[model samples]
Target chain A: MRLRADLVPQDNLSYQDVVLVVDVIRATTTATAFLEAGASSLYLTAGLESARAFRDDDVVLAGEEGGLKPAGFDYGNSPREAKEAPVGGKIVVLSTTNGTRTAHLAARSAKHVLLASLYNAHAAARLAHQLATEEVAILCAGKEGRIGLDDVYTAGVLAEFLQIMGSYELEDGALTALTTRRAYPDPLEPLHLSAAAQALRQVGLEADVPFCAQIAASPAVGVLEGRVGEALIFKRA
Target chain B: MRLRADLVPQDNLSYQDVVLVVDVIRATTTATAFLEAGASSLYLTAGLESARAFRDDDVVLAGEEGGLKPAGFDYGNSPREAKEAPVGGKIVVLSTTNGTRTAHLAARSAKHVLLASLYNAHAAARLAHQLATEEVAILCAGKEGRIGLDDVYTAGVLAEFLQIMGSYELEDGALTALTTRRAYPDPLEPLHLSAAAQALRQVGLEADVPFCAQIAASPAVGVLEGRVGEALIFKRA
Candidate 1:
């Protein structure tokens, strides 16, 4: 499949088979934890405005920009916050700078769409493999307008797993990550120099580093498929 | 400086003080040859319509879409074609589906840009190092939206040179190449299995793989920095 990791989202995503959107860092990871914790489907919006405007009953409105929660949201894009928040059996109107926008954009093209993270890398790969009608494209939610080491690194990890599976054809994005990962077995060594990487590293998120670095842990698969308004990913499904 | 190999010339270009664009398949390598052969400048446009409309006695309209030369263009995005053309002391208005687009896009962000190819890797690196302003980001012109292996492979060679120079910050893109080159030192192994690699393998350009694999021709620095219309690149200018 064709895995494309573009900084900007194209309105007409060339997804036909199955499309997997990965926001591994904080968004999809947070979404997976929230879903695994018994939260119902999430309604992802591209921005904080649409999310804040939603007034559905029993829906948890959450997200962040520049790492801070929106002015009047009930939650932020933190795994800890998702684990602790009361979101079970309720809808979530979520929004984030990059991840959510990617999900929304990817949904426009694929026959089936999924949100992936390190937390759900294998599951996403497996499901992506099974459900892929033609090709699979993995879209990583990069930071701002530059290359975020975390996303590309995570993309590399997923690519490693996918390459091992040995059935599907890899598109450019996956190849980019796979070749890159092969090129640099240890991606963390260089993270210290990046502005965003340094910021995350400074916050003692070093724990997350190793955690995310692990090949595939949670094996959860989050998706944004079908009609668009109703975002749902059938995990292990 | 963050050195990256982008197969496609969208955004997420590493803002190294110096930017190197590689179209290993042909355009970039040929562009370097053209400039060395004494072409004045290159104007990279997105489509044939714009490239065909150019009217300048001193300018040679060149390039194509889908690998075929546009009906009215003077040249196509092929190094062999460029080598055969008469571009001495003339501006070449260029437009290719990928390379020119990349050049156009990179010019929007990079402070300085250059075109590098297997034909001129060492020369470009030396010039890039000499022009070092802040950092160097290597932009590769991939086939379509995919990251071409040749570009990444070439980027790896340049990344090592930069790394040896010391005191430079390597972006994930550059580091990815540096690490990849180390993993598979053998150039003929299809190190990354990327489509570009496969394409080259199909055409027996695999030998070019080994040639581009070696870092620096001992002392040949492929230094190219220039502009074409609004898009100013290191090599085409």
Candidate 2:
């Protein structure tokens, strides 16, 4: 098996069988937590309007634009909020600056798209390795189309998990990610080092950094079931 | 001052004033070594035809297509070859798979463009820091448009050099690069771990990896002088 980590979404996704979309600073962490918190399904949208359009009595509109919860949204892109919310059997509509759009973009090229974060690194890697035919790509949802330290670090954790299950050939990006993962043994260190973490700090949402770094706290592997319009619908695998 | 590393060429070059183009596996390494070896100038072209077109009695046509020297070229993109060649007071027309094209692209966006490698990492960083108006971007000429561990590692080394000269704000990519640099203290480790190194080894040019990894081997900083036809001209600073 070949494992590659794209620090950002480059033009190298077409050959991947399984792609784990990572936005560990919050997006994937929150979405995975939402599912683990008993949300029936999470709808990932690229824009806020699309996420808002899905809001219904049972659907929770959740996400952040620039580290702030969008106007009138039910919750921010916070794993802690998603975990605490009474979302049992309810659907979640999420739109974030990087993670959601990245997931949608990756979904177009990959056969299987799995949401990954430190929150569910082990489970995501296990599911992706089992589902992969040849290549498993870890796509980091870098902040605003730039490389994010948090996402790359999470990718390293996921790559390490994948390596334990099977023998895999790593690409340059994967080697970089593994090196990053080894550099910071504590997940929160990288999460704290990221631009996303700083953005959240500026917005007084600093707690989310550590919240998103809980390694394997949730066993939920958010798998793409299908799409509802432009929104990708993910359900726990 | 602000420092950032683009692990790959992303769409984020507009804000940069000084851009250090790094392709440590060979292109930048060879170019820097050539300048250090008393070459008058290096003309960087993006294609084999353009490189070959500049061949003359005084101009050395050099570079590789896929890790091997092209037919009828004076030399492959090797630092050792550049270091030992009788390039004194001669012009070398060079083209490679990634680095030359990357330098051309960056020259269009940056105020100052410097060719960087492990060969001149410290000097390039010092020159860039001294020349920057505000932001200094380390642009890794990633392998065929994907992240190369060797270049990213070199970027990290450059970023560290900049830090020693002065205090600067680090962006996520710079942070990642620094982490990568820290993970591989011995430089040659990341150089050998890169796919670029593997390709070179397969082509029986394994010596080039260590040759490229020799830190600060050259004091020459290949600064962009101007353009000659489609080639960007560089001379030692």
Best by lDDT: 2
lDDT of model 1 at residue A193? 38
lDDT of 2 by residue, A1-237 (tens): 999988897554464589999999889999998999899999999999988888789999999877888999999888889899889999999899788878987898789999999989889999999999999999998987789999998999999999999999999999999989999988888889899889888989999888888898788989999998999999999
Candidate 2 docking: what grade?
high
What tens digits encode model 2's per-residue C-alpha lDDT throughout B31-61?
9989988899999998999888888899998
The digit string of per-residue lDDT tens for model 1 on B1-237 reads 444544345654445467787776666665665676567666666777776667578878777555556776777565555655788878776676667777766666666777776567777777777787667778877766656666676777777766676567655456656655565566444333556556556655444344444433333223335544554433343
Highest DockQ, which number?
2
Candidate 2 TM-score restricted to chain A: 0.97
- Over 4 Å off, model 2: none
State the lDDT at A165 in candidate 2: 96
lDDT of 2 at B4: 90
Find the candidate with the highest TM-score and give its number: 2
Q: Could you give me the TM-score of model 1 versus the true structure?
A: 0.80
